[model samples]
Target: MFHSPRPLVAAAAVPIAFGRAGVLRRPQPRFNLVVDLTQQPFSKRWWRGLATLTALVAGVSQLAPPLGALPAGTPVAEGSDQARQEAALAVGALSQGSATGLTMSEGPLARPIVSAPARQSRSLSLIVSPGDDLARLLGRNGVRVADALQAAALVRAEKALPAPGTTLSLRLGAPDGAGQRPIEHLQYRARLDLELVISGSDAGLTVERRQLGLDRTPLRIRGSVGGGLYWALRSAGASPTQAADYLQAIGGSLDVGSEVMPGDRFELVVAQAKSADGRTLSGGLLYAGLERSGGSDLSLVRVPLGGKLQWISETASPEPVRSGLLTPVAGPITSGFGGRMHPILRFIRMHKGVDYGAGWGAPIVAAADGQVIRAGWTGGYGRQVRIAHEGGLVTSYSHMSRIVAEGGFVRRGELIGYVGSSGLSTGPHLHYEVLKDGVPVNPLGVTMVSRPLVDNRLMAAVRARAKALRGL
Candidate 1:
């Protein structure tokens, strides 16, 4: 049977009392402090009690130890040493005394009893780049300026730094309290047969050079010119430098691409410096030779000539004679040199040069190697090119569509301008003229000049040096 529930007494409230454990306990009847739980608007006592509970909770939390730490005399569980060490590190507590270490007064690890952290040395491995010296590289890597200079100087006492692209190893000492590191050890290859080492010591830095015996001899490489001479030389143990040097020396006289046939035997001798284990450390081409089965053999050797080493061939042929005057272009002479009736002016006038009937924009070449005196606009010649040759002689190409040589040297047979009726008259044609001492001369029926012969003494000296290089 459900009887009517007893009504809650409005005056009944849970009173607060402080106990020995600093916790809330039941209050006695004599205690006047009490709270009315059923009241909507809290009285002064409710607010005061809420504030007092919050303050008590915060105080308890502040006084409790962190999770990473332990209470005093708490024996660490067995086999949990590693975990404890990690936790201690997380809280930044040292196992030994340090100026910056935290003081855990009541934890399992007491103040001044934490273990000290091991000091670690720093190291850096660097590759020597282009434009980098030893001292600059070390200082850039965080070594003290003074220490870097000292170590670099010590290394230089034995030998200078290695060339670029060398790998260097450096070990730095642990930084001091002032946060400065010193170079402890440095090592790098100084040369093909020598190594430089700088080791720091209590006295000072000591430099040591370790050297190995190397065989410095001329190496010979021979092969067949089946496909390409350069690639064949590379496959026969010649470095790229040697192969390129060989081509520049040999290809200038002979067109290796066309003249050098397949199955032709080729020989190369180069300067080499090798270690004991048959490893080539340095080499360069000294002699490049080619023997053809059905043609003249070519042999070039490096010899001292004109105060410097130069490549010269013993079986070199003399250069062919070249004509001084070459026709600028092949076309019909529409007009001849000397005076004639002016086609545009309709009067008798002095026609100074000959005219050639050429296609529109036809190329015009220099008659002889000379400097271009004028290349832009002229009085009635439209666009003109004037070249001053040897012996006070000058050649001019006028009435051009465009001018190419602006104010520099132009060689014979080199294009100077294109034919056009730019300035004076007519259609597409070139008015060519030659002047001796600034006076106009006839362009046609002029005597051609011949090339000179090579000196007999120069040729004899060249042959002698070539034989010396071949040890004949």
Candidate 2:
């Protein structure tokens, strides 16, 4: 045990008494001593006295060992008579008040020992790379194999692991008795609005997921056709998906390749989900318009009608027009509308429509804007769909492998079904027909027209929405 020499210093001071005037008066021949054990050498007797005092101050039954027990180079010695004389002279000077104002410091070994500060844990930041998983990342960062595997299992169970290039915050504790530095905690962004935290010691682990309430902001973009429609939209901060939606909405009224010339202006409004930190998520176009140099401006808006999203014209009176119909399939005509020999029945019969020679599983789109009235298996036409258009005109598609648009209003160029050889057919092809007031007409010769407005109120609402989006 070690003890400071401050108590011994006070004990060596002279006594004081109070005088008649209530003032502190020192005794005759009073002196103050400041013994500096640090700077002056000491004899064996002095060392023994210090050891005895240390034992008494520590309340120990046994006295401390001599100062000779310390490491070599200590100033204390048993046979240094010169050192003893110097110490005696220092004590005599203190008694005579010769060192009243001097300060005495103890040797380095006689001072109180201080312990070093505690070690703190270190933190590391890591980024996930291509073809890397949680286990592999943790292993490479000096985590134990068992711990890495356990943490990976926990992350996989949540199914919220971040993609490549995501940053991960990790903390490593100090090395334990086994010389192993275990992971303290890890943090990662699981989604744009959610963050995942994994933490624990070697005893147990815990996982936490925090949600960030993000918001969706609507934006409007307007620009001229500088290089191309796609480039112009991209330059105006429109994503590829949003640009595609804009093109599809106005495809019925405008042809980008042939109709759009240089200096044609276009505008679009889109809604995008964004986090608090300005990270963009999914987005879609809400309205779009195109103004030609010398032609009518084409405007379209998306509206919620009958629990479904429908794109309609911005005009108040959307009348039946005859310019927006497209050919459903792209192939050569196999049969024309007229009397023909039935291949299966081996008899002459009147074919009311045309047949397209297309490969099996070829995409079949709508010819005009209309609503699907029938979508099911017909008598001679297996897997058929009939759509009612404007001017009391109806279009029917027969011999389809599958129907994608069922009982809904579909725009021109939107996929309706796939080509197949079903029912009374010779090979893989599509049987297409056009009808007027319940009478079958020649599909190849008949002109296609747009459908009339079903609900005036819906059209009015769509127009209002378009106006609002345009002003955004």
Instruction: Point to the candidate with the largest TM-score.
Output: 2
Displacement of the residue 200 alpha carbon in candidate 1, Å = 1.6
Predict model 2's lDDT versus the native. 0.77
Taking the tens digit of each residue's C-alpha lDDT, what string does model 1 give over 272-336?
78877565665666777888886888787666654655565666445643344556654678988
Report how far off residue 235 is in candidate 1 (Å). Answer: 3.2
Those runs of model 2 whose alpha carbons end farther than 4 Å from true positions after fitting are 1-123, 129-133, 145-159, 175-181, 201-203, 213-215, 316-324, 327-366, 369-410, 415-445, 452-454
- After TM-score superposition, what is the CA distance of residue 330 in candidate 1 from its true location, in Å? 26
Where is the poorest 10-residue window by lDDT in model 1?
Answer: 92-101
Per residue, candidate 2 scores C-alpha lDDT tens digits across 120-151 of: 57688999998898898988877767677878
Question: How far does residue 340 in candidate 2 sit from its true spot (Å)?
Answer: 20
Clashes of 1: 6
Give the per-residue Cα lDDT of candidate 2 at 93: 37
